[model samples]
Target: MLGAGLAHAATPEAYDPWPGLVQDIFKSRPIHDGSGVIAIEMPYRAEDAAIVPVTLRSKLAPDDGRRMLSITIVIDQNPAPMAARFELGPDANVMEISTRVRVNNYTDVHAVAELSDGQLYVAKTYVKASGGCSAPAARNADEARGRLGQMRYRQFKRPGAAGGAREAQIMIGHPNNSGLQMDQITQLYIPAFFVNELRLWQDDSLLLAIEGGISLSEDPNIRFTYASNGAKRFRAEAKDTGGHTFRNEWKIDDPGM
Candidate 1:
């Protein structure tokens, strides 16, 4: 619930936003500590506020018996606090996810995991970055316009991954402009134009699906590790706020395990 009334004028160190966030985002549901469920990796001080790297790792063992249904990332003080919600494929066995997000202020980034057993687990980490949501796009207008909707996919064989575990990355070219950013030439706010939905598949089965928001940085590259199902094809489909749809497919080469 980054829409309204969550804004605070108090210094980042003096104010707390987690309690209110729990109510608006989770409907007052109980959130347990996620130490045993998941872990969040981020820089203590990001070199660039506009593109801060964050990785979410599942902590459950292979024999844990419970699956991670989905995970939500929240940049508590960002203009749009809820950055993204990723739903994992039941059969993919996704263990890790990495992506970039904008950090508008020095704030606590929370990763809430919803488990198959109907429990919400929360993990927190502090990040020191500012002015991200309103930061100008890295590329010039012309350059950005040229690459709109371009998508790329790559798969990497994990050295010792069991059951054909593999690492893959998907990159989509889009400006992902937040409505808060000002256009240097026009001196007016840029209209929000970003990829709001992304879905990945291995052949006919879902691998992952993401519901995104303005807090996600431009370009939106997502890298993840999953147990490959010996499916011969990988596919991706993305949709933006402007209603443009981008789709791509690639052949999944055998890792020769």
Candidate 2:
């Protein structure tokens, strides 16, 4: 998360932020050729700035049976550039993911995946989206605050079931108002309120912890992966920029989650 320290690839206004943002964020972890391994799905023109959907899929070959280490999502033009990060477990094998994020302006969204072998693969798409992080409040203050940190989860079959790399989808409820947003009625800037972190676990084992920012869409959604050992126990912990905290846990008898 490089604090929008972007100076596009070109120049002042013409500068594309991808090059600088990527360099700053990855630092020593340089990128290599991602020819056949990674794919990113995003619309050329995003219909909504606040809820732009982005999907990611991987093509891990049969020979590369190692579990994926992690996935990092980056929006190159937001105030805080790094949107979220997903860390996977050893038994994990799937990598299909879909999430919603904000784009302050027309920018590139990058999905970088790290394999167990420590190799990184990247996929990126330029989205024609704008004004997401600073858009006006989608909901009133009371309504947004009441639902902050609330989360929803839905499970899907892992790779073995249907031969696809998908496990579950988690949606978190939060205003994520950048504090730069203005209230329609009051015409005053909404105070900075957003979900800053999400920690997920299965039974006693930690799965992934996503550090988020204003770049995360309101009611952020993520499709993630986890191993179904014996008990399908899941837990999520979320915190907001406003200092409010929330937690939820569920146990599923079925191994699907």
Using TM-score as the measure, which candidate wins?
Answer: 1
lDDT of model 2 at position 166: 42
Alpha carbon lDDT at 185, candidate 1:
94
Please write out the lDDT profile of model 2 over residues 1-257, one tens digit for every residue: 34455544334566677777767877757676665676788888999988888877776776766656777888887888888877765555545767788888888788888876778778888999888888876777789768777788787665465443447777887888777788787888877777888877777667667777777788878786545555567788888877888889887667643
Clashing pairs in 1: none
Q: List lDDT for all candidates, in order.
A: 0.93, 0.75
TM-score for candidate 1, residues paired by index: 0.93
Candidate 2's C-alpha runs over 4 A off are 1-13, 157-166
TM-score of each: 0.93, 0.84
Candidate 1 residue lDDT tens string, 69-156: 9999999998789999999999989999999999999999999999999999999999999999999999998999899999999988
Residue 179 lDDT (model 1) = 97
